[model samples]
Target: MSIQTGDKIPAVTLKVMGEKGPQDITSEEIFAGKKVVLFAVPGAFTPGCTMTHLPGYIVNADKIKAKGVDTIACISVNDAFVMDAWGKSQNAEELLMLADGNGTFTEALDLVMDGSGFGLGNRSRRYAMIVEDGTVSHLALEPTGAVDVSAAEKILALL
Candidate 1:
């Protein structure tokens, strides 16, 4: 089953573009003792994600944090290198650009989505959640191709 409210985030190592190179950051390191807004995209630079989803968070990051969020992270089933480039290109310096390159974290959350038809391989489904000290307090899932419920606007209101 997909992750839901009250579920502890799955333990897995994800990558981020560190000062030296791609570095590892575990799920526990991210969610433990922190209130986090974690969102996932089907791919790094897709139309909906780039134009709408990710930008919504980037634009409203500080406002979201003002409501007690400790971190705002965006995850995609792409390599760290690409994630880094995408973050830089989008000016997403305020957000954590997490790279779930192997999709292990997505699989552990049971949120994997097949994108073979679009020339993309396995990917994480579009969703967002509020995680507090390793436990999810709320989850918003997209309906297949929609970005409505999981957009940052909705999440900000919830917070």
Candidate 2:
């Protein structure tokens, strides 16, 4: 089943680009003892993800932080290298770019979507959530091919 409000985020290792190379970070390390805004995209660099979804979070990151969010992170099914390149291209210094490299974390949440028709293969569905110290306080899941509900503005409003 898809993750719901009040559910604890799954324990999974995700990758991130580090100075040395791709580094692994567990879900517990990311969410524990922190108020985090975690958002997921179907794939990195895809039209909707690049042009809109990710930008919303990048632009509103400060405001979200002001509401007591310790971190604002973006996760995609792509590898760490691609996610790092995309973050730099978008000037997303304020946001955390996490790679769910094999879609393991997405699968664990039951949020994986089949994107084979688009040649994207297994990917995450568009969604965002407020995770406080490892538990989800709010979850916004978008319907297929939509990005309205999961926008940062909506999450900010919730905060």
Candidate 3:
């Protein structure tokens, strides 16, 4: 089953392009003691993702924080390098871009979507979840092929 509210995030290492170098960070490191806003997109730089999904989070990050969020993260199936570049391109310094390159975490959460038809291999569905102290508190997942439900503005409204 897909991870749901009250479920602890699966323990897995996610690659992040850190200032020093590539960092392998665990879900525990990210959500163990923090109230985190985590959102996933199908891929980096896709039309809907770039134009609305990620930018909504970037634009409303401070408001999300005011609701007691400790961190806001954007996740995708792309690698650290691409995620880093996308973050830079979007001017999203305040958000964390996590690279779930291998899809271990995505599969564990049952969120992986096959994109081979698009020649993109496997990717995460567009979705967002709120985690507190390692457990999910809320989830807003897009219906397959739908974009309106998982937008950052909707998530911010939840908070």
lDDT of each: 0.96, 0.95, 0.92
Write one digit per residue (lDDT tens) for candidate 1, span 1-159: 989899999899999999999999999999999999999999988999999999999999999999999999999999999999999999999999999999999999999999999989899999999999999999998988999999999999999
Q: Give a tens-digit lDDT track for model 3, residues 1-159.
A: 999988999999999998886789999999999999999999999988999888889999999999999999999999999999999999999999999999989999999899999999999988999999999999888887877767778888988
Score every model by TM-score: 0.99, 0.99, 0.97
Model 2 off-target regions past 4 Å?
none
Task: Give lDDT: candidate 3, residue 67.
Answer: 93
Evaluated at residue 153, the lDDT of candidate 2 is 96
Please count the clashing residue pairs in each candidate, in the order shown: 0, 0, 0
Worst 10 residues of 1 by lDDT: 1-10
94 Cα displacement, candidate 3 (Å): 0.6
Worst 10 residues of 3 by lDDT: 143-152
Clashing pairs in 1: none
Clashing pairs in 3: none
